[model samples]
Target: MADQRVAIVTGGSGGIGRASAERLGADGFAVVVHYAGNRDRAVAAAGAVTGAGGRAVVAGGDVADETAMAAVFDLADSEFGGVDVLVHTAGIMPLAPVVDLDLDTFDRVQRTNVRGTFVVDQLAARRLRPGGAIVNFSTSVTRLQMPGYAAYAASKGAVESLTLILARELRGRDITVNAVAPGPTATPLFLDGKSQQLIDQIASANPLGRLGTPTDIAETVAFLAGPGRWVNGQVLYVNGGAA
Candidate 1:
């Protein structure tokens, strides 16, 4: 019956998305690794899942686009029966102080982060079978009040609100909606062109004394999507006591 467990992990081409896909596959869920533009990486991630004795498929779409998300869901239905879990990790974070942020940059971030969450959450709410779960991604910036992250923080704030509201709206559907807020994670996006000195400074700020790994956040997602159903409507902060 484990093969009956199908999951769709948005943005699964890299970072926490890829980690969650791998973990879900390891947990016996047939995963659909969804990517926006990185086809090769998405295929590789799916292949890794299959190589680990699990079933997986690669799907491509822009999470902020409703039509694209619908196509992805259709592919999942055609390829693997139905979606049992939806892990929405597709987002964009461009840090800039509000005073210095360009309107276009802010709009792009909102379009990808907030609009993307809305589009994917709508699909999951409508298409996910009973006993399914939806996991949304947030960031610790919302709680940390960090400078140069006004737009990014606002976007994640919307996700947190949406997750809680959707959980309430889905009252008796047997589906749990929740969000995970990760701290400074060492993804390619975060480490690119950053100095080791700055990275170390940021790492030292976390109570855990290090930057978070994608696997660290992915493990929490696996729990929420699997047996952690009782923890509904909660913004589970996996920030290693940083916030």
Candidate 2:
């Protein structure tokens, strides 16, 4: 096993997850890129880490499944000694007003966003090495109170609450638990099906006058995971002043 610290980033195939994984690798953590279904992208992310003079491996599992999550932990133990950091960023956003939101979509979103976070964090609480950190993903929409985001916002609200409580619960372990609430980021998922006019309008809504980038959020994650250890049990909003 590598003597370097190890970090496992779920949804590491793209967007904020990928960016955070890369940043953590560059920060000297041996990263494990976890993906649900994108093998190629996961491999690419691992390659990026290795190319940057860090150790990395690709692992796949459903974040919401206990058995799968157990396997993921096992992989980390066998491959990198043990997990020193855990970042839960795997989530699905199916935007719809509460009145029109499909039951299936709502359930899936809750499963991935809420339950997945709980499962992964439960494992982390039990297994993370002392001084390790757990970073959960939330949304600026939870504070922005935007339309068509009731379900998504509600899910992230749970994550925010969980992070705070988990921090206290793990107080003896010296593990810091925190959440990053990102605003309108320019990810593929966010850009899909949006016109330039709509995108520009959204950009103007932020004080920064542009949508957030994955790197923007990733930098915050890196901080909370690294030298920002004192920032426990808080939701650091990286929305360019949108909230």
Candidate 3:
């Protein structure tokens, strides 16, 4: 594994993060599959990586906790030697209109989505090797202005801004920092409270006429993590034209 690349995929327990962890592993990355709380799912993700003839390990932490996340990067160093990519997909999404959203809920969303991103990105920025990539997650709803998504959208807007400044901040380090703003997708996060009719309506509104699959977003994460070198500081909307 001397010449192998290593990827630390946050939120690897499920959804787009799980798909991305497996994809990067298939692409020959030694992976650190990170989870917030789900050990079983994270182990399965690591299994997928190793089953594909790649090296992998499981790490768990709250992304906003510096000590917790630092341990995760240390695991990468100890187990895989070094880190080359950070696909930061760990986040919380709760939908509430601005008026109805409580201060506690708003603050919690900010802490997890905004501060969590900052913490992980900070670790990635410091620890990643030259030519490494940092991919953060955003949402197309920031532009679509969907009702009941104010808290989430505001958080992602911060992510987009952070992605840009961090890319410039890492100038000449040969690291690429970008954000993936996925549109309406079929992940549990996206499907959890909506009705079938609303889901169908969203699918129909997309030019592709379907909800995006987790693998669809994962493919783009793989690209940004690897060969998409020229894509720094940009937010790629992976919404099938829904935005």
Candidate 4:
């Protein structure tokens, strides 16, 4: 099993994270599914991976907590030999205009999105094996400049910066560091409270005329992790022309 590739997917308990974990599992990588608070969903994701004939285990941690995330990475190394890919799909989105957004909300978003990416990517930079890849999450709102997304967009902007700099810093290491900025993905996290009219409007904003599915984002992650070796230090916008 030393030749097997291993992935640590943060936020693997829900939505796009779940899809990415399952897809990577299908791609012949042993996955360590990391969740923040939901053990049941993490178990379910691990089960799906195992059912698909891939190796997987569930781990729980806050992405911004160094100790907790370090434990998750350790689990991957001990369980599957070493880490090869890291898909950081864990983040939070709270929609409020910049002027109206509370300081607490801004702080929370920055802690989870900016600080979380920093914590996780630092570990990946130190731990990923040769030829490994790191895929960090961003948001199309960064480009779309949509309303009520300033805090979220600003946080993702920092993620993009980290991703670009890390790829350059890892020269000669045969690793790729990139960010995927998805737009209007149709997950519970994106759709839970929106009115049907607003949802329809946003869905139609994309040229595809529909909200993006989790699998759509996962396909892009899989490419960066597995076959898309030449792509690095770039932000691939997976927004279906929404931007």
Candidate 5:
């Protein structure tokens, strides 16, 4: 295992995070599955990796908490040597019109989406070995401009800004920083509370005429993590032709 690359995948308990964990594991990275609250799911994510002949471990904490996240990174260092990839897929999306959204809800969204990205990316920047890659999550809704997604879009917009600027800042480190803005993926997070009509509309918006799967997004991330070294600082819209 001395020659294996290591990846710390936040939100490994759910959705794109789980897919990403398994994909990176299959790609030969010893994965550290980071979860905010669900320990069981996190364990399952790690188990899938090890069950398939890859090494994995589970770490738990809010991604926005610096001290807690530092411990999570320390676990990766202790268990797998050093971090070579960071897939920050942990985030929350609550839809409400900006004029009607509660301040508390807006603040909570910012804390998890914006602040979490900041804290985790900061740690990744400091700890990742040379040639490491950092992939953060953004959304196509930011482009779709769906009416109720104002707060969510604003938070993700911050993430996109962070991705671009950080890539420039890491100019000579041989590390690639990029964001994956997936469109209308068929995940619990995307399917929850949406009407069938809405889902169909979203699927139709993409030229592919179907929804993207976690694996679809995961493959894009896996490329960025491993062999897609020349692709840096850009947000790849994995939305099947959705703008």
Candidate 6:
């Protein structure tokens, strides 16, 4: 129906991105599942939305490519009437200490995380209906200051800044902008290089004593996207008090 809300979830192929997409779908938003290179994974995400009787479709492109991402937003408008929410979760994490991190890798991470966010946020800022929301992804590493996370942390730091500034820039537009900074979550992005011992150490450091699941983060995204009307220009630390 024309009045049904639509959400475009970037990085919907896996992890927290997919979980947020699923949760929003369950909440009755028509979803545009956007992926960069994983069509099969994205297809399954869309299928989960459909399988559970929610409306969904898949759109694929490089999130940093303005033209490509513009097309993704266009597809959402064509398919779902208009966009009401944007969950920008497409990003990369390349771990290395500041001294050892390759400049090229750092550039790539920023290109995807920072620039991709700019491209998508620009589009959403232009097209999202009033009363919409934009949720950007960040990492608690920005606060944790963990070693081997210099490049990744820097990128997310940019995300947090952009989210806050944009929220203020959209004054009177009725669109809420916020970033979700998650602590050591068990997604592939967080667990890829850590040993079980290291993982356990990080988990135990949290007062809650465990790694965050995607659902934990998704619930926050859902709240900000839907009923959390007053939560504007904020960075929600969705960790279990690790930071």
lDDT of the candidates, in the order given: 0.93, 0.92, 0.94, 0.95, 0.95, 0.94
lDDT of 6 by residue, 1-243 (tens): 999999999999979999999999999999999999999999999999999999999999999999999999899989989999999999999887888989999999999999999999999999999999999999888888888888888889999999999999999999999999998888988899779999999888889989999999999999999999999999999999987
- What is candidate 2's lDDT per residue for 1-243, written digit by digit as tens? 456788999999979989999999999998989999998999999999999888999989999998999888899899889998998889988888999999999999999999999999999999999889999999989988989889999999999999999999996899999999999999987888889999999999888899999999999999988899789989899999988
| Candidate 3: residue 222 lDDT (0-100) | 95
Runs in model 2 lying further than 4 Å from the true structure: none
Residue 233 lDDT in candidate 3: 93
lDDT by residue (1-243, candidate 5, tens digit) is 787899999999998999999999999999999999899999999999999999999999999999999999999989989899999999999988878999999999999999999999999999999999999999988898889999999999999999999999998999999999999899998999999998999888779899999999999999999999999999888899888
lDDT for 129 (candidate 4): 94
> Please, what are the lDDT tens digits per residue for candidate 4 over residues 15-81?
9999999999999999999999999999999999999999999999889999999999999988999
RMSD of every candidate to native, in Å, equals 1.1, 1.0, 0.7, 0.7, 0.9, 0.7
In candidate 6, stretches whose alpha carbon ends up further than 4 angstroms from where it belongs are none
Clashing pairs in 2: none
Check candidate 6 and list the clashing pairs. none
lDDT of 4: 0.95
Model 1, TM vs. native? 0.97
What ranges in model 3 sit over 4 Å off?
A: none
**lDDT (tens digit, per residue) of candidate 3 on 1-243:** 678899999999979999999999999999999999999999999998898888889999999999999999999999989999999999999888888999999999999999999999999999999999999999999989999999999999999999999999999999999999999989898999899999999999999999999999999999999999999999999999887
